[model samples]
Target: MSVHILIIDDEMNWIKTFSDILIDYQVCDAEDIFNATNLSDACEVLRNNAIDILFLDLNLGCESGQDAIQGLRAEFPNSTLVVMSGVTTGSIPLMCMERGAYDYLPKAMSTDELVLSIQKVISRVEHFDRVRFAPNDLSMVNTQLPFSSYVTQDEKLHSVFEYLKVVSMTQHPILITGESGVGKGVLAKAIAEYSRPNGPFVSLNVAGLDEQMFSDTLFGHTKGAYTNASSQRTGMIAKANGGTLFLDEIGDLSLSQQIKLLYFTQSGEYQRIGSDLIETSDAKIVFATNQNLIELIELGKFRKDLFYRLNTHHINIPPLRQRIGDIPLLIKKFVHQAAEDYAINVPHISDGLIELLKSYCYPGNVRELSSIVYNAVLKSDGQVLTFSDFEFPEIRDIESCSLNAEPETNDTSFKRLDDLFDEKIIDALRVSDGNQSKAASLLGVSQSTISRRLKKLQI
Candidate 1:
């Protein structure tokens, strides 16, 4: 794809030569090549042109290129950041990465190296552009939603969807992991829908089950096998024949339970309780966990063999706080759905309310967001929903407390901390002309930290 590229260097000759080569290669037109001499000039250029790639020289007179990485990243999040330097030795590249440079390039690059760098940057940016969420009336305008159950506008999640789509071609057992409430179960079902659309999708949460209960639930028990076994009962594996069997909370399984599961996952063979005859199901196995299985393995609580058997393909859902972009779409979808389900007139939502809600870090992820939205809908007594309609434990406690004490004194410290951090974030944003990266630089924090604080403060 033809792209706009900006080159920043103190040497005007280098910029001219580079622009000429890129234009000759048909990578971009003359009008698309923007050149700047330093970080200040580069920022000014960015304000006028949203380039697809930025080639920033490490040495710009007296300025180091590393100084621009974070600010540029914060301002033009979608632009590819490449740091070119004469000195790329020691931990310079690593330092650039920490500051958010996408790639590092040596100044003395051959034509082949230049071409390869351009190709690499182009390829990376193209993937991001393809999967990036475009705003629409409701959700985002993409190829299609991952599934009806998912309400998101996160590029990271979209990348995850792309990966799942590719892996669906194989029948390997899939492992899904995430923090609780990030919707591992929902992701598991989406994987099932994608991979085994024609077959059933069954799920079981095996967190608290014992050996007998686990075995009975997974493998059907024969009649008269136990005191309560008065009739034949089919197991989840049998019920999910020819489809996907999702085992949630796999990390909670005991070592012995892991053995049984490992055997079933390794070979489809299993036997009914009190019956010697072996039975097999054609179900595709899927496992999910919020816990760190690797950590559990280190502690000897989980079987390494079982973990290997289940981790043929892995998907980890990021937490809600990391993908705040989804907040608007999620709010819209949940508001309408809740109104429809409860048979209430839909309340008009405002950008203010959305902004307020977006600031909250949903520890419960999508499920928590849904609950908050549903509760607000139910509590509203007017056409428009407001902050009063929503009840947050942190907010309420924060409203009731004074910030004179330590945070550990009570849950009220959450709001206390917010009150303190929010002031600094807002001040920085104001001083920096509302650029999150500049604000972060002013406050000596990461850009994401500034962004999150602003969101938390609903600024």
Candidate 2:
């Protein structure tokens, strides 16, 4: 079905221009377009029609657009409202976002930029719809945690999901460890959604935050807390009251900040900066880090006490390279998503392309793979995506080496060496469930050797 877009702007010329742009870009059918010059008309259209997207001009001729944002949001909660204004001061956009606007775009944008903004909002709306109305199949259920958007067919991820379910119900602080771009934040959100569905999920990246910033951001400052502090600010913990406070990149917290966080974790109380009164928050803490906390603890970079408190429930997400079978599934999802975002036909993924992707060790994990697919789709001219479409440097290097390298002098010895090491490595990896360390131990080889062979053999 074509998406219905309602454009509310007092300027008839601007409305015509935006309408023409959307029509030319094929954002929606011409018949699906609706326009209103004022708040009353916009409300009437919203009440009568199921508008998929609403573009509201922040400055109506005589009406204050901000006044209508909350009302419209309350009336049409499903419609994705995008606020547009000529004001470039940035505060208006932030205010609009705080008032539940899906996005804010400068009214001076080119047609392409405007279309891109609309497309982004549409994609988000569609994603939320899919998540809300996902299949009720028993097989799709995690069976441990409540249903979430994090889908996986891999057994390792399924085990993680199960563990997340058990940990979600507890108030204990959780530590989720994984490589960067392995969806640590996504898992944290899933945990929050499962445990405190109705409460706010407040996230703060503690990396690069100094002691003062850390304390102020987490345990917000009261009025007159500092020279620049003119008003009171609620900290993440208080904002996440009765919900989950997700502290990402916790490994970067300094020793002093760690001590403060540990105190809060143990006592569930904190005082705002420059405040005499102490406040308490019932926010569940969830911490995630790509860094090795144990190593940091040993190095005296991370406090042992804080580590113990955070690891009351620990989960390690396996890297994408270890779950090769999920590569095709993730590619398929990303391809369809990219197609929808670009307003183009979904490109087909060939088996050769899938095999090529599966062979490479994705150091950046699932996020890197998604980027590869999206970039390929952007460059694709045909329906089918082949191996050449992917721009992975590692794969190209391995191929170049194989084709250009000189032949071995002892062909028989080379053949024997390849068969012996390759077969044993493959067998060991199978037994170890794609764990390189375990595979190396089983084969009595160093982990580095296993890694080198896996790359050399293009496995």
Candidate 3:
């Protein structure tokens, strides 16, 4: 599938340069790559042909490209518009996204960024071809692979499920990122089941592995290739051929290992450790990570290009805190699973217990909730699972901290929901030692958001 690109800009030289790179990468031929001086011409080109990507220069001399974004998006919903700007000042990139641009890039970005940007849109275009969902199905829930096995009536997850269902159609790499225990692996398996049900689903955790180990595990070496290579062993990629290969804890991958994985993703080619023989596998790669990749890229711990590559179909699962409404459903599922595992009767859940469970913030997320329920099931001899069955170390710590919270100022005991939230924020701040930036990161929010909350609460 050749990518049809339309570069809408006044600069002839920039179009020439960009089109040349696309040709070099074999994204499309010269004839297929169209150019337009302005949005009108761009719209004409889009209307004339099925343009996969529309690269609009944020500057159009007299015309404001930012102002035209919403109109362009409305007129050409299928064409993915990537807004490029000369001005990289505050909130402009965010504004482009808000205004319906698929991606935003600075005009002065490196050749690498440009290539990655183009690749990102191409990835989406390929996704457009693969995705079978209609627009009306955006709110679809309670169906599909992962959702079929699990139970949830949370409104927030409706969008997540629908998005995943669409993304699962694409053969390109899918990146599932979220806080820990948000079921990234489960979604990856669902992708496999939905996309290629008969194919194998192989998973590998790359948390503690070094470069040599990572390569050896992902790409098997031939017999006698290494010290312990007495027999030839197949790697996860080979094992998952024609299927899905899930790489968990991908954030822990070192910079060098990231480069290797990036290359494999780009080319679908790899060579086993100490073996000159190159191999290719059609294993659909699925990556999961809890770390903030963009921050890691800024800190030079992660590659920017790799980030874009894996972000082809990024599916971010909101943590348990954001979707607390699903606690009852999740609790029910966990309880049944625990009872089935123990070969015991399913204990009754009290409304008071539900309230108590919902009050404590789940730092460990759904995984932690399951552990609590399972452990409680094992301990309880009666018919009901009570509040004593659950563990909330943070709640206990907060209670202790409230005694010393503003000891010199005011005695603010947690009472209302607002107070509980404020206490949570204060606890995060204290844990981060009054560093607002660190506190924001700990709370999984922006520093500005925390600042606003602090000001509003007068804390």
| CA lDDT of each prediction against the hidden true structure | 0.76, 0.77, 0.77
lDDT of 1 by residue, 1-459 (tens): 668889999999988888888887877889988998988888888888878999988888999778878988989876888888888565576567547776777878897788887886787667555545424322232346445567667776765676566555455688888878888887778778877889999999999999999999999899999998999889999999989899999899999999888888888989989899899988878788989876687688988667656654677777777777888988998899989888888988766446656666665678888898899889863256755466564442322222232113454445554464575567556666788876665444688887776677676
lDDT of 3 by residue, 1-459 (tens): 877888988889989988888888777899889999888888888899988888888888788888989998889877888888787765566566656777878878888878887886787677656553454444555654446665567775675676677677767799888888878888788788877788899999999998888988998888999788998878888999998999999999999999999999999999887678889999888999999887686678888778868875677787776677888888988888999899888987765456546655566778888888898887665366644455443333334333123112233432464555576567667666788886665444578978988999987
Clashing pairs for predicted structure model 1, backbone only: 359-455
TM-score for all models, in order of appearance: 0.59, 0.56, 0.67
TM-score ranking of the models: 3, 1, 2
Preferred candidate (lDDT higher): 1 or 3: 3
For all predictions, the C-alpha RMSD in Å is: 14.3, 23.3, 11.5
Error of 2 at 214 (Å): 1.0
lDDT by residue for model 2 (30-116), tens: 899999999999999999998989999988889999878998988898798888889866346656665767677888888788888
Count steric clashes of candidate 3: 0
What would you estimate as the lDDT of candidate 3? 0.77
Q: Which stretches of candidate 1 lie over 4 Å from their true place?
A: 1-148, 394-413, 416-459
Candidate 2, lDDT over the whole model: 0.77
Q: TM-score for candidate 1, please give it.
A: 0.59
